[model samples]
Target: MIGAFCGSFDPLTLGHVDIIERASRLVDTLYVFVAVNSEKRSMYSLDQRLAWLEAACAGLPNVRCAVQNGLVVDACRKAGARVLFRGIRNGQDCAYEQNMAFMNGYLDPDVETVCLFTKPEYDLYSSSNVRELVKYHQDVAKFVPACVLKTLLEQEEMDENIN
Candidate 1:
């Protein structure tokens, strides 16, 4: 079965990698769907996120990233994915995700959401934290994947040039 993992994936943290790796074990093929949400104001653009994702999963088989410009359910349908994979980090996340799952089900009953709890090792890591570290010029090599680090550096160069 094809599973769609949808997220903003601003910097593709290690936590994100862990979730995807676990998801891969459960599905035949996994499509990492990067969504564009204006409200979120991500540091990386859609193209940048996709590039980072591609680099992170470069050697991994049966895993690919794509830009899906719509609701999660619509994106799943467009990608021909049967299940949606989400990584829940804590109780607060669970409550929010449960509501979203129900709403998404209301929109598309055929598409199911499979929530996976984040590994304890990465329970505290999040995109928001990653962004803060990057903003402060802190070394985030440990928290983010290599590809994401490359993209972040490249974006810094672009920003410098624009200035």
Candidate 2:
């Protein structure tokens, strides 16, 4: 059955990619959902996030990606997904994800939520940290995927030239 990993994906980090790689192997098809959250503004636009994800997931046959707005359960249903996958890097992350999973279950009983543990190297990494590093002119090569790094660098250069 198809499964989906849904998140804001402000910028696709190595951690998110790790989750996608593992989740893809567990299901017939993996849909990467870039869900929009209105309450919190994102560093990058939805279009940019989607582009980065497309580049990061290139050549993955079963991995499909799209921007999802509205209820996550609706995104799962629209994608014909049987599972809503999340990545947990530690106990704190696990607790948060578990609560989300439970709420999603309450919303849609037909879809199951699964959490995959992140690799040790990416355990403490996050897109917010990556953005902070980029803002401080620090190398975030270790935190984000190559595609994201490339785009980030290019955008940074553009901003510099603009200034």
Candidate 3:
């Protein structure tokens, strides 16, 4: 089965990797869709984010990456993916994802959304936290995967040089 994992992936944290790895085990193919919403601004550009994601998921055969600049459900359907993989970190995440899941169901009944709870070790890591650390120019290597960290650090250095 083809699955769609949609998120801002501002910096692609370990939590996102955890979900993708888990979903890859359950599905035949998993497409990591980086959400590029104009209204919900992101710290990194879509090109940068997708590059980070692609590098992070390099070795995973079942996992591929792409960028979608519109509604997630629409993108999922357009991609011919019937399952949506959502990673839940806690109650707060569940509450928010639940609404989105219901709304996605309402919009496309055929596209099923499944929630995968985060691995205990990654429960505290989130994209927002990574973004905060990046904004302050703090070391975020420990929070995200190596590939993501590498890209972020390189980008930061480039930005610093530009400044």
lDDT digits (tens) for residues 2-104 of candidate 2: 9999888877898999899999999999999898887778989999999989998997899999999799899999889989989988899888988988899
What's the lDDT for all of these models? 0.88, 0.89, 0.88
User: How big is the positional error of residue 161 in model 2, measured in Å on the Cα after superposition?
Assistant: 2.1
| Number of backbone collisions per candidate | 0, 0, 0
Best candidate (score: lDDT): 2
Q: CA lDDT of 103 in candidate 1?
A: 94
In model 2, the clashing pairs are none
lDDT of 1: 0.88
Q: Which candidate model has the greater TM-score, 1 or 3?
A: 3
Model 1: residues >4 Å from true position, as ranges? 154-163
Please give, for residues 21-48, the per-residue lDDT of candidate 1 as tens digits.
Answer: 9998898999998888768887777888
Best-fitting candidate, measured by TM-score? 2
lDDT tens digits by residue: candidate 3, 102-151: 99999999999999999898999988888888889999877998888777
Backbone clash pairs for candidate 1 read none
